[model samples]
Target: MYRSEFYVFDQDKPVPVIIRNYTQDDFDELIQIQSECFPPPFSSELWWNKEQLSNHVMRFPEGAICIEVDGILAGSLTGLCVDFDPNHMEHTWEEITDHGYIKNHNPSGDTLYIVDISVRPRFRKFGLGKLIMQAMYHVVIQKKLVRLLGGGRMPGYHKVADTLTPQQYLNKVIKGDLKDPVITFLLRCGRVQIGIVENYLEDEESCNYAALMEWKNPFNRT
Candidate 1:
């Protein structure tokens, strides 16, 4: 259980938040938060089952982290190490996260596959997402991993799903011609859209397609 304290602005006033590793005790809270943060189809069917949940802590103990602000379980993130050639493969969340058990996770792998992150609804506007992302970066450097990769639900897509292709919409958002709360924020955090992943997730807002992204570690530069 790694622990640290940081602050993020809440309505322009800084509020203190805690960052640390996930614990079995927090599992129920995680499940509750997932239900609140995501919809039924995805949240219910796709969450880590009992065995997978246990394996998360046992396998990649160092990478699963949680966020707390004033003793509230405000957010959390869990990752797994994956060995893959960036040039030749693309994987769905299940394939890379190893169906949540992370059964194939290689502790010495080159990439950190971020499988899940959830922020409580009330805490969403306080910049917690970026804070958690920085924590993930810290994990990459701490583990000496090469880079991080994942797919994110494009919340902005539902508004334009009928009018534009996923790629076109993402390009516009990337170019600043369009604004996407989720995708835009990640872009600011130094991740870029690698491509569109079909059936990447079952979220309603993104229409089941996620924006594939990657962030290289600054520490990896040599």
Candidate 2:
């Protein structure tokens, strides 16, 4: 178990937060959290099912982590090891994450590819998502992986889709002229934008585009 303490904005004091590997018992809660995180436009059909969650913990327990505040399951971050080629990083979420089943997990892979990360809406003020991401970074270091990579959603894009192209919007976000809920948060967590990935997922807000981001393992000797 990976443990830490954090201060919740509305709480009186710091709460005990624990990051632990995904287990069979967390299936229902995990699905519930997914539903709350990605409601209507995000596609309920894409939510975590028994099969995918089972494969995640079974195939790579270390790559799947959940965070609890006090005692409530507040969020989760899931990933899979992959032999990623930085030069060819144009795959869709389904292709890279094996449709969230992680059936393509490579034990000897150089990168830890993040599939999903979400924090409960009520707990979003506590910086839990960043903490969960830090847990993934620890996993990357433990496994001696080269980096952590993921296709991040641009939920703030569609609001300006009529006025800005995806790339243009991304540029503004990077330059701090604009802030995207997902991309801005990821950027603050030490990830850098690689490029804009088209058709990365089916989210109307993003116009079906994703921001490819990566956090290099500075300590990696390879």
User: Number of the top candidate by lDDT?
Assistant: 2
The whole-model lDDT of each prediction reads 0.82, 0.90
For candidate 2, what is the TM-score? Answer: 0.94
How many collisions per candidate?
0, 0
Regions of candidate 1 where Cα sits further than 4 Å from its true position = 12-14, 39-43
**On a 0 to 100 scale, what is the lDDT of residue 75 in model 2?**
95
lDDT by residue (149-171, candidate 2, tens digit) is 99999999999999999999999
Task: Summarize candidate 1's per-residue lDDT along 1-222 as a digit string, tens digits.
Answer: 578897877768878889999888888888788877866555486655567667888888777888998789998888888875766555677777766778888977899988888898888887787788888888888778888888877888989999999999999999999998788988987898777888776667889888878898878873
- How good is model 1 by TM-score? 0.89
TM-score for each predicted model, relative to the true structure: 0.89, 0.94
